[model samples]
Target: MVAAIASVASVAARRIRGGEGVATRGRVLLTLDPGALSHLARGRDVVLVTGTNGKTTTAHLLAAALGTLGPVAHNASGANMSDGAVAALATRRHAPRAVLEVDELHLARVADAVSPAVVVLLNLTRDQLDRGSEVAAVATSIRKSLRRHPRTLVVANRDDPVVVATVEGMPRVTWVAASAGWSGDASLCLRCGRQLVAKHEWSCPCGLSQPQADWELDGAAVRGAGVTTPLHLRLPGRFNLGNALAAMAAAHALGVPPGAAADAMADLESVAHRYATVRHGSHELHLLLAKNPAGWAETLPLLKDYPALLLVINAREADGRDTSWLWDVPFEQLPPRPTVASGDRAADVGLRLSYAAVGHQTVDDPLAGLELLPPGEVVAVANYTAFADLWRRLAVMSGR
Candidate 1:
């Protein structure tokens, strides 16, 4: 009765709060029934995608790929903790399959409960330093969880040393040669604690090395299991291409044909507006979310072509309180363009840029910063809460 009431109330709240009640629903369920998530997840084919970055997009892709087989329940709004999974599963109890994005630190708990048929580990990086665990600690947590759930098949990135180390000897692991765009986090060897050497493949003097991949991501295609399919996606960035490869490999493990899965993913334009563009006074404002340094490393290069750039930073609980990670970003690599920093921590962002010798303006208000950009095309990059703020502001501006 409590489960039913919570689900119904959550649906009602979603309508009133513009679809922001998923976490609330999950919280209510867990509060009233401690085992609500595991109970709701029973008898469902589940795939849990967890990592420091690309969890949202990879979960979206995996959900889309599985949709080709049957109805899939997914946390499309990016609420990725155990509570969020409970909300998604409870609301769609009849769905045969579920693709959930799990938080890095919560993967062990969620995986132990859900016992997902497949788990995709993207890459581990330094993020949310104020409250989150360090890279090695996060990897150790996942390693222990996978040992507990021996039946789960893991699809891991071979290029990322941390990811490779996490699923090293798992019997049913499928390694994908996904690009490790940021290697700063994996400089030290996980096995020998010695410095790793990265050339064609990352290796340690103690004999730890990148494993042979069952599925390889070639430029625009994924080749594996005697098939190659081109991923024609509306999402931008090479990191997304690697994400697609991971999704395809996991889908194949679930018995879905690679071609059909790729076809299903092509229509997905964006994941919670990661690369979504909104109209602003006769100009196009492209929005991208970059929370940590690794994400910024991949996102910065993609913005080289944009005529104007706006960066928003915030230190809310959702976005780790310590803004020191901003210094790790490769702002020096940013191309010459009209740039502006806006958000609660816009001053911090501006200071970092100043040290990088990139001239920029600081505006505490995001919408006001948008107004300052010259009309043509503006690329906006923001962290967690800042992105949500700008997304809401754009919706209100358009009277949505």
Candidate 2:
């Protein structure tokens, strides 16, 4: 009966707001039946994907791999909190398998409610500084949750010190050496309170160190469980390779064959807008979203050779009220190029670029900023809200 009502609400929401109503439908369902999430999720094999970054992409890969077994339901649009999870689960009650991308701080609550069969911990980094908890605090919360659910299998990233520390003593853990490019947030040890010694292998004075990974990424190939397969991903960057490895580990934990998982992941074109190219006003814009310093560090290297790029910065609540993290990003590493800054905090981004000695112009609108660049293929990077706005604008302009 609850499923019937929630289904009707989801349909109504889609009719009223189109694709934007996905989260709203979940809200309406939860409001009508507060306990609908657990009821809907019962007796299903749930894979909860959680971390500061790449959760959505990992969930997408896992869903595809698990699809080999049967019908699978997931939060494909990346709405990963309680409301979003409830919406994804309630809307697809007939599917036997469910994959969810859960936010870092909300992992404990969501895990408890769903009693997930597998929990994939990608990596932990400082993101949305003004709105989210500290890195150590989030790690602690995940540790407690893992301790409480001893029966759940954990697919953890060995490259991330914080992630390794969080799931260290869990009974069932599949460690994956998914390389983490950003190391600023993990310079210090999360467990021993001492500085960590870094190298190919990192260890602290307190004896805590990276665990031997059950699954290891060797270039584009992942080796594990007595088999190795090349992971050909359409997505760019080493970070995405790591996301694929994490997904492979989670897939294996759920009884999916390793070779099949790699083949399934290779077919993915994009995770929403991580690497999507769209046309707007006779110009092609490649969209990339970087929310914090760690994310920026990983994303900026991809634009080193571009002749010009558009960068948008916003301080909206979704983007965190604090914009201080912008200074931490190494914008100077890029070859000298004309960068057009946009969004609510356009001046702030311009100021940071100036300090880095990178020449740039400030424009308040994203589209106008893109127009300032010479006509051709261009790259546009933005924070949370700014990225959403740019995506919507591009879609409308292209009649998508």
Candidate 3:
């Protein structure tokens, strides 16, 4: 009774107020009945994907893979807190399985409630500077949570030393060497507190090192469990490949075949405009979203390949108030080209580019900057709120 009312209200609120209403719904349900999520999670197979990045993409892929077996409920709207999980489960009550993307900090609490069948631990990096904890602190919290849920099968990244160290010596674990690219956060050992040496694999002087993998992403193929299955994904970047591998490992732990999971994820082209292309006027804008330094490190190199690049930045509440992380980004590495900075914090990005010796202009509006570009390809890399604004604008322009 409470669940139905809360879901209906949330939908109405979303329609009237705009934006995803999972948060509102979750709040209402919890206010009315605190045990709503626990009640909905009963007698269901659940998979939880949590990390600093790739949580949304990995969860989407895992849900799609699981959808092959039956109707699976998931939070596709990117609302990842306890309330979001509650709202999704409450609304889709009949679905026998659920795959949820949980916030890194909220994972332990959410996992405590739902007790997921499998947990996918992707790479962690510094993000949400104003509000988020340090990488090691977040990992420690997750480690403690996983320790509580002993029966939950953990599918963790073997390539990430922090992730590997978290689940070290834990039973019922499947490791995936997904080739996580960002090494900035894991330069030191989490357990041993020593400098990590990286050659073929990352290891610490205190004996904490990268673990052997049950699943390995080998170029275009995923090899594990005595079979190599090729991934044909439309999503760009090695990070997406790593995400797919993490999803595959989670799916495998939950009884889905790796080949089938790979096949299912191949059709996923975009996840909340992480790598979406939009046509605005004469310019074809390729959209890429990056939040923190690690994300920019992966995204910036991709922007270099484009004919023109647009870097949008925002320092909104959701985007983290601290714009200081901008210095941590390797903007100096970006090739000299036609570039523009626009967003709420366009001036900040413009100043950063100046320090890096990269030539760029600033525009109050990103669409205004788009008018300056030639009628070919333009790659736009934006943070959370910036990407959402651009995505929403393009959606309105296309009348969708």
Q: Which candidate achieves the best lDDT against the true structure? A: 1
Give the alpha carbon lDDT tens digit for every residue of 256-345 in model 1. Answer: 899998898888888898788889786699989999989989898889899999999999998999999999997988877788999999
Q: Please list the C-alpha lDDT of all candidates, in the order they appear.
A: 0.88, 0.86, 0.86
Model 2 ranges off by over 4 Å: 16-20
Output the TM-score of candidate 2. 0.97
Q: Which prediction has more favorable lDDT, 1 or 3?
A: 1
Question: Candidate 1: where are CA atoms >4 Å away?
Answer: 1-3, 6-8, 15-19
The total of clashing pairs for model 3 equals: 0
- TM-score per model over all chains: 0.97, 0.97, 0.96
lDDT of 2 by residue, 135-253 (tens): 98889988998888999999999989999888988999999988788898899999988899998799899888989989998877889988888889888888888888888888888
Quote the lDDT for 326 in model 2. 90
Q: Give the per-residue lDDT digits (tens) of candidate 3, residues 173-291.
A: 99888777778888889998888999987888898877888888787999987899999899888888888988988888778898899899999988867778888889889988899
Model 2 residue 377 distance off true place after TM-score fit, in angstroms: 0.8
